[model samples]
Target: MATVILLRHGRTEANASGTLAGRTAGVHLDDLGRTQATRAGDRLAVVPLAELVSSPLERCKETARVVAARQARHDSVRPRVHSDKGLTECDYGEWQGRKLRELARSALWKTVQTNPSAATFPGGESLPQMQARAVDAVRRRDAAVGSAHGSDAVWLAVSHGDVIKSVIADALGMHLDLFQRIQVDPASISVIRYTDARPYVLATNSHEGDLSWLAPKHRRKRTRSRADQDAPVGGGAGPGTPA
Candidate 1:
């Protein structure tokens, strides 16, 4: 088995503003978003990463660059950055630029909320379609990684919130309908250790801000290493959280 870490890109203007980015071009990371991504990179830098990859989208690319640099194996990991479109965010189609609340009021959006598993936005893809694409991207990447190297290789993949969640859900053998429970925040970390048998979650929602519950001590001290604090809990190398 291998280990895979799925990182969600940091927030964007569209994300902070609550707009549906939906495959928009040039929608780069905002200032706070960049800092957040950088901090996440700092957090991940201390860990040993075998490989790193990312979605082709600008946000994810930028985020991955920060993380790869932090890992100090940028050169080693750069060549592995496969620009897979399958990891792209959900295509909001015509509603790409619309606000979430505005879209929520639309009849189609309502349908989506009511039946996200089956609803498809006009001129866009459905949840199942997105899940399928995500599974393909994730599985193919892992298979390639396994084929290229032996077991014990740990890889990091930076992608969109929904994309990472879909991939994790697939790894868990959960239905697309269950994705709602898997919350991926900006620059959040989700881990799956692939063993000879199956993949398993090492951590999820490993982001800053409100993840204190995952590590109450990290929240209290705010200075102690998460690794020192949470290692006993997760039973892993350390708190795979971003430093």
Candidate 2:
């Protein structure tokens, strides 16, 4: 199947202020967030993105536009950014817009930190529910892109930190409680490729490094082999090497 690059939206006032922005409206990226998004766009400029999907939230939309704009300067096709509600930030409900420090003091906070699978936001959804929707959205979109653009196609998804983390956790077969262990910094990029057998996490929370290797290359016709569904015995020559 096609590969998907998960991009967390850049920093925001809430992030700098240590608040939970959640699904709050009108929350946009701060100045540093814009620069961060721009840098991420620059890194991805060499790759041809088959699709650019983003949360409808302002911050994510802003970041997605920057990435799509960069692709426009290089690729003949200007990638259109599509909004997906499924990729939106978690519904923190009453916790929305609250300072993280204050929330940290609540008893539920302990449950959230230790057993997110059982934690539920007051008036909102559970961690499992959020993961279910997010994983479903990513898998559905990945399948669509693969069918439309072929296995070599690469795409992007700009979303919130928790949303991206949940997706990554699902890709790694990790339990929801362990998801908090994963760190998704602002504008960080993570890569995942799904196959009939399983999903491969190629990268995580990557802030720097040459991503041009992700650029899709034409594949020569060949018979399918076990390597197609399994990792190479030794890490396999790195990307760009022939099988």
Candidate 3:
């Protein structure tokens, strides 16, 4: 078992303007976004993260870099940013750069809002596929971290808002249609603990906290499995997989 810290990338110009950036390239964080990410990094600087995984999108990559830089300040080995396409922003297709207010008037908007499980973007992926990949990505990374670092390992996944919400829905055993109720804001922190029995949703959309308490406790001396002792300290193509 391990804890996966899901972080939404900071706000972008599209966010401030209420536009859907989707997977459009070159969308970087705004000034406020930078500040928000910096504060998030400072908040989690003391936590011992086993790995830093991020969406390949520029916004997520930038946020991951800031968090990793802060973690590097306290740890002997600097954390590396592992890109995962599975965590990328949902492909909004024709709505990639549309304003939300304008899109809200479209007939498809209602379906997206009320029944996301049945919604599919024109020329893009279906909602179910998006949720599937995002959930799988997080679960795969959680298992990898637990196997390599042990049950108490804490890791991070920097991704988009909808993707985080979908993963949160899965962790809570909620249906995809109801995932819309979970609002993930810019630079928010959501935590999920996966154990042998089930997943625990520790926190969601959290903007404030020391987070140092997430550090694994100092364990009493005990015999560890040979596999655990022989696990690689560090080595991987990336922390998570793509769809």
Candidate 4:
């Protein structure tokens, strides 16, 4: 069996400033965010990190590097940082760089609430579309990383709140709406494991140094979607999906 560690990036200046930052430029980690990264890195540093992959977005990339560097894994395990467009935050389109609450108070919120799939983020991507892109990206990543490894692979993917939630939802056989229920704090660690193709949640939405459960009660009512997603919404440099 292979172990996979899913970690969310540290908080960023954009998060503190209340900006959408969808693929925006110059949105880097703030002081608190850096501390969050360092602490998260120290906590996971003990684990044997086989591979470290991050969202191409700066926040996640920076966080991944910090964690990989701190992990003392280079000796026992080879750790390198790689970027994946698939692992990026949701593209809020025209909504990028705007306060989510402000958007919720605006006219756009109605469209999003009513027809989430049809509602475009003005210039960004939809929720379902984001779910598709993130799911596909992770699947491809697991395949690539699993194939490239000679021994058992333990992979870590650092990503945005929403992206990670989507991945977790897919792993748990849930929907995008359930994403709202699964909370991913900044610098959190959510674990998903696979004995074969079937995946079970070992943990979800864990903050730095968290040993508690993020809840594992699998809902039996919802139907699991098997649709495959392969493309990215707005591609790269989008602001992370802040919960």
Report model 3's TM-score to 2 decimal places: 0.89
Which candidate tops TM-score?
2
Candidate 4 at 113: error in angstroms? 5.8
lDDT, candidates in the order shown: 0.72, 0.90, 0.88, 0.70
Using lDDT as the measure, the top candidate is 2
Better of 2 and 4 by TM-score: 2
Local accuracy of candidate 3 as per-residue lDDT tens digits, 21-135: 9999999999999999999998888888889999999999999999998888877557999999999999989988999999999999999999999999998888899999998
Q: What is the lDDT of residue 9 in candidate 3?
A: 98
TM-score of 1: 0.80
Give lDDT: candidate 1, residue 70. Answer: 70
Per-residue C-alpha lDDT of model 4 across residues 159-198, encoded as one tens digit per residue: 8887787789888887555566778988888886544437
* Candidate 1 lDDT tens digits, 173-225: 88777777788999888877655456667688787533222222222212223
TM-score of each: 0.80, 0.96, 0.89, 0.77
What does the lDDT read for residue 68 in candidate 2? 92
Displacement of residue 119 (Cα, Å) in model 1 is 1.5
Which residues of candidate 4, in runs, are more than 4 Å off? Answer: 73-78, 110-119, 150-152, 208-243
Candidate 1 worst ten-residue window by lDDT: 212-221
